[model samples]
Target: MDFYGIDTAPIVGVEPTDLPVIDVNDSRMDFVFLLEDDSYLHIEFQTTFKISDLERFKLYDAALYDQKKRRIYTYVVYGADINEAEEFLDHGSIQYRAHAIYMKGYDGDVIFDRLAKKIHNRETLTDEEQLQLIFLPLMHTKKEREELATDVVELAHQIEDENQRFRLIGATVGIGDKFLADSYIKKCWRC
Candidate 1:
């Protein structure tokens, strides 16, 4: 995918059966998709920093590997800023890790302005831009998320293709939920 430079073609909608089973109250994975090359792409969205998350990822990796017999690539997209950079877990010979995409690392205003300019010029958004818009809610301060989500939703509506618009809206809501209130996110979705 353009957002993470994933080169393999995706096998959309393919679900893994052997992911770790949990009790009634245990948390599950955020997102999982199988790639055409038999690799599993795992994505997790985090709004709060937790040490237990890394342990969860390790379990996910083990279960995914058990089911698919292919390599698993995991990524964590953080909504809030975290000072720690512990993206890996190592216990002697065994190790588990995830690629971290810290939203705070990006300049939200620059990305938002670029998207706005494209929308203003009546130009269709490219795939990369669409991905950027989806993650825009996390790319800025908590105070700026609502405003950016509004603008991103507005621009998303301007996209002519109904399918693309819908997908963008869905992705926006998924990521926006971490930063924006439910009501505001619903309004953006209805835009």
Candidate 2:
């Protein structure tokens, strides 16, 4: 993951003290970071949108709370945008606060330039405030294969099982269709 403009410094109190793991049954979360205030950040990356994702996070949040008694904030890091996930907040019964991170294939240079400017001025922003930006391509066309690789790289990092990794890579390659394999490159270049 590119941290050039990403503010990972706000994170504190991360648990397990090891690399982020993928075993769902295990207490180790998919991507667990911490807020400056010591709150928990649980991230789940989904390439394929599933209707049950919200509830799944809710269950995870409940489990975390049951174990640690601290408020846990959750986010769904996804390749595509989802309205169904948004609707989950409409129902009154679920109390756990959650949000979605939509990833997209876009002009890496443009996004990086914007992020760089923001990071340079981050010190001017108030404490406890951070930016949440969704990277969706300004132009969305299923034509380009390399564009989709941005999402695939994230998938490779998050999935632990080798078989699953191969399967995901296969799926991502299929998404590319016929574009040159070399087309797959980082959204942003050097800092």
**lDDT at 181 for candidate 1?**
76
Cα lDDT of model 1 by residue, 57-98, tens digit: 778778777756988888888864654556888888988888
Pairing residues by index, what is the TM-score of model 2? 0.46
Error of 2 at 156 (Å): 13
Clash total of candidate 2: 0
| Clash number for candidate 1 | 0
TM-score for every candidate vs. truth? 0.79, 0.46
Off by over 4 Å in 2: 1-9, 17-28, 81-84, 87-93, 105-191
Which of the numbered candidates is closest to the native, going by highest lDDT? 1
